[model samples]
Target: MTLLAESPVAVGPPAAPPADRMTRRHKLILTLLLGTQFMLTVDFSILNVALPALGADLGFAKENLQWVATAFALPAAGFTLLFGRFGDLLGRRRLFLTGMTLLAAASLLGGLAQSQEVIIAARVLQGLATAMATPAALSLLTTSFPEGPLRSRALGLNGALLSGGFTAGALFGGVLTDVLTWRWAFLLNLPIALLVLVLAPAVIRESRTPDKVRLDVPGAVTVTAGLLALTYGFTAAGTYGWGDPSALVPLLASAVLLTAFYLIERRAAAPLAPVRILNRPSVKWGNLGGFLAFGMETAVIFMMTLYLQDVLHYSALATGLAFAVPGVAAVVAGLGASRIIGRFGSQATLVGGLVVQAAANVGLLFLGTDRHWFIVVLAVLGIGFYGNVTAIVGFNVTATSGLPDEEQGLATGLTTLTQQIGFTLGIPLLSSIVAAGAAGYGSTTAPALALLGGIRLGVAVDIAVTVLGLVLIAVFLRRAARKNAV
Candidate 1:
């Protein structure tokens, strides 16, 4: 999508101060970019509802059905930085449009797939295109909005889009998959993306640094391979029995590539990810906190949706509607985060939000058949509100604000990668815990309850981690305060 920027730089020069920058019509541009994010988000989980349809239509074995999801997620997770950096050096608008074009081709091809392998290949290409587009969308956002109120507002909208996408996807998936055709679900993006590609030229301006620098091709490839290996290894455990050669090989390969990635980043003149930006106090802790938060959050949603359908015997629409509560609350909280942070300080707002969410997880831990689902859903929605929007996206804005223009893309990439990693890792991690817990019990209520227990255990771990992160924020603040006092 074309970002209608005056210059090619991610963040254009400080235009005539706050007064002039306030007039920036980023709202319209973002409306289109977020449409892209929504489609990707929908596609990821929309398949969960349509898995049976896909299996029947495409004749996918139990082992390969997941590839439809993994193929897309892995490529997107693996290449955020690879493509984000390309946008920085090359041109975000160009990279953005090219990604949409590629994804459009893949999506149309996917709609016409006659074999499982062909469909999987299309999904992989689609993921790559998403990787290129998603980060570019975010980086363009950073550039389009100036550093303070505007940027935070823009990012808040992004958070809303993200939270809303998950709920919408599930709801639409059932309708599109059942009523029309499963292929239409995949085909939905064709028109939306085409519209974005067309409108982007008029609404969004192009942005890139004027400096000519060689592309960091090696760094991109190595890191991409490394992340793919890691995610592939983790996500494969479900189908491969964790002991299968396919699983072990990818996991081991990921370990090796990850080790190599660090070494390559250390020496590269034009690194895909700059190690230095990671050195910032806020940037480091913020990223650590963000990763854990998104990872646990994604896993929880996945588990809960299944529990409602498989165990609690709720219909797909009811399950989807239940999730909409949280989506709405997240939208409300996102709009308020900037104001809250300004009033309460970033540490207070962020730590306070995490603490409350830990409490919510504690509440969710006790949920079972005897309990009221409405109450449980309400608590979960409330928990989601402050926990998500105020934490990851807000922290990112604060952390990345300190970096240089060149490093902005890298900063966005690192944070985006962390979220993607969390999403990728969360699936298998939570699944293994639940599946293992179920296996320990017989084919009865005991096993089903055990799955709930596994979710509880997972949430407990997340609460502990969230608490630890909050404590770290506390320590980080006190130390900075003391240093300043001296």
Candidate 2:
């Protein structure tokens, strides 16, 4: 449970980048890493605003349009752990470069795609590229900066840029779709990926786990398939009913595959995810906190978007602009996160962040059809964003804090995996709740009123879940402290 304390186990000496001073080279390295983090995060939301335009131009069926987004999400969530292990086994820098190269190719293909099939293929490639890049980039960041204030600062910026990227993607996607074309949304990544490809090799040094362990092929295959099925199941449930075969079949398959993965890992000589690492309280509870933080945040935002567009009758561009203020708040939170963590510690900061987030959700219950409520919505979202960013940084710092140098990749992989899963599943889960709530309204109910009722119900559930997670995490940390004392 020593979530904040350094691990006693040191497989190898930690990387000694000038911990005392920040040099120009260090600045370059930090920029490269943070930039990559921002780009990857943006990919999650960039296509969302453009989906309509992209679908129309490419002849995508209305029912199948979700696949454009899901295609990218499935492989990204599914293969992240495997690629993360590959970073440890092969080379982090090597995997990063390969991912960037793939991203560039995928972006080009997507931008020029003339058909639905081609675009989906491009999206799948983009997903694969993200799977390879995200963990490698994160592990590189952790290794480059020795753990302490420096590492906390780097992670804070990483958290900030991540929130900023998601916000920007929505805003930029709207602008591009309106002014230029949906193709610009895909084309934008080409330059960013190329820049990273050119500069990363020069600035970042290659590092990997020192142990020459064999890859656990069975463990990798099972876990990858399990996660893919899990994500697909949730997505289908969101679109269709939970009891539908599309959702039920995948959910059942995920259960079986994940169980097999667990058993295989137990028996494997070199497990893909070591049981020892998974056993750590920080890794276990920290990731759970991460999952809730991301899942709830995403769900809240999705509902808010629906409220804006459906009830408030705002344009896509206007809705994007509305969220921009919160994005700025998140950036501010990220910039100040290190100071907050330094003063209060990761545990306290995380708890405080969750409290603020819960309070913000409570404020969102005041949302109504009145336009003046937009002011309240904006204010609460800003507060929520600030809390979410700090909590996210706290989760990252706590989860990866005590791990050995050799497992940094694995640790970062787990951190990012929870985030992707949270993002992928959050919307569907909350959307289903909202749908059910809306369906309960009588035929005499107004459409706006029914939608508003559904949104309120969903927000109430989100608040409760956030509170529950906060309590559980607090109890877990408190017990760990008592155990350490004993």
Candidate 3:
């Protein structure tokens, strides 16, 4: 993909603007694009606090309940690459508007769903909408802003909105579930989606790649099939234990499919992901960091929600309110990210953020059944969230820093793809660890202690994974920096 300033893609390239300074119109455009991103992210976690309520009301079995989250995440993670390239082939403005309309419709369907199958289908539709909108919206932002301070600031704010949306969704989901009905959680998206739909045509301009690129159908099929199989295997492992054929067969198939995907992409006429871009260290390591940043934070939210409601017996509203502090902190960190990156550099910001997150995970080890203990938990989570904000902003900037303008959609697609995959995989993997540990208590430990032990184990897994991410960033990113310097 090549994006030329003088590219033939646009019927009329947007009027040339001052290269460095942002205009009021630019700010409005950013707001509208970010709003769409926020909605997409919100749906990812909106169901977290509502899970229990939703399960009980819908008559979902305990093992089948996680599917509610997975159903949305799977399509979003698996199909984003195809949709991202689609946005470049088709008009981005058209795709963005269509996605919003579908998202609103899905939310309505979810609210009105009578059977579990209907609700799960609605969630899948929502995921498809997200897959379509996010890349288009992000590509629009990168093209609208030049690749400098203006772009860096925009990415930082976008990261902030993304994190804020997830945190806020947890709170809002709880409030709606407690005050009205769990169905309200889905219904709430209607107004926001409708509003974005109404205003989007005026604010967002259309953009696409001028040179026609054929879709890599074989590559797309293999990668999507691979991710689905992989995600399902992990989820099945959580439900049926690692020894079951239910888990092993899918895991093996995923391995074969993903291998085929790589081989196919290597030779495809128009690769779903270009080989050279995937080989860039900055792109590779930056996305790894991003995966950790998104994955662990989501796991934290899921675990905390379960801990507060299942063990501490907090109401949905209370659980949501508890997460507000950390959520606010995440926004602040996002807002300040450009300055932080300017002072410390993207590498430093990312590594430091991961370290802080690791420390916060350690702090979670002290959580007890007492509601008063949440004060400390929320405080520590705020600090961790701040780190997450910095890492998210820094990783995004680094990942796309050297890519050509034509590949902006691909870069952004890779970025969001890693995040969606993280959310899809993290919950089940971490939840399984907690469940396995909890089940092992076997009447030896007190039931309360056993549950707390499981929760602590979950926190420990988060810490270990985060530390591993920090190590990878330190080693790989530093090596890339040295290579570039030389």
Location of the lowest summed lDDT over 10 successive residues in candidate 2:
1-10
Q: Please state every model's RMSD to the true fold in angstroms.
A: 3.4, 3.5, 2.4
TM-score of each: 0.89, 0.92, 0.94
Candidate 3 residue 235 C-alpha distance from true site, Å: 1.6
Candidate 1, residue 19: Cα displacement in angstroms equals: 3.5
Top model number, lDDT: 3
The per-model lDDT (C-alpha) reads 0.70, 0.81, 0.82
Model 1 local distance difference test score: 0.70
RMSD of 3: 2.4
Superposed Cα deviation of residue 466, candidate 2 (Å): 1.6
Misplaced by over 4 Å in model 2 are 1-20, 404-409, 442-449
Ranking of all predicted structures according to lDDT, beginning with the best and ending with the worst: 3, 2, 1
Taking the tens digit of each residue's C-alpha lDDT, what string does model 1 give over 196-280?
8888888777877676666667776777898888778777766655787877898888888877777877787866566777667
Taking the tens digit of each residue's C-alpha lDDT, what string does model 2 give over 1-486? 011111222212345655656667667888998999889888877877677678889888765777788899899889888887787777778899999999999999999999888999999999999889887887777766777888888889988888777777777777777778989888999989998988887788777665566878998899999989988887787667688899899999999999999898777877777666778777788888888778888778778777887799776677767778878988999999989999998987887888888888898887889978888888998999899889989998988887675555557667877877777777667876786687679789998889899899889999999899999988998788689889
Give stretches of model 1 more than 4 Å off.
1-14, 61-64, 241-245, 404-406, 442-450
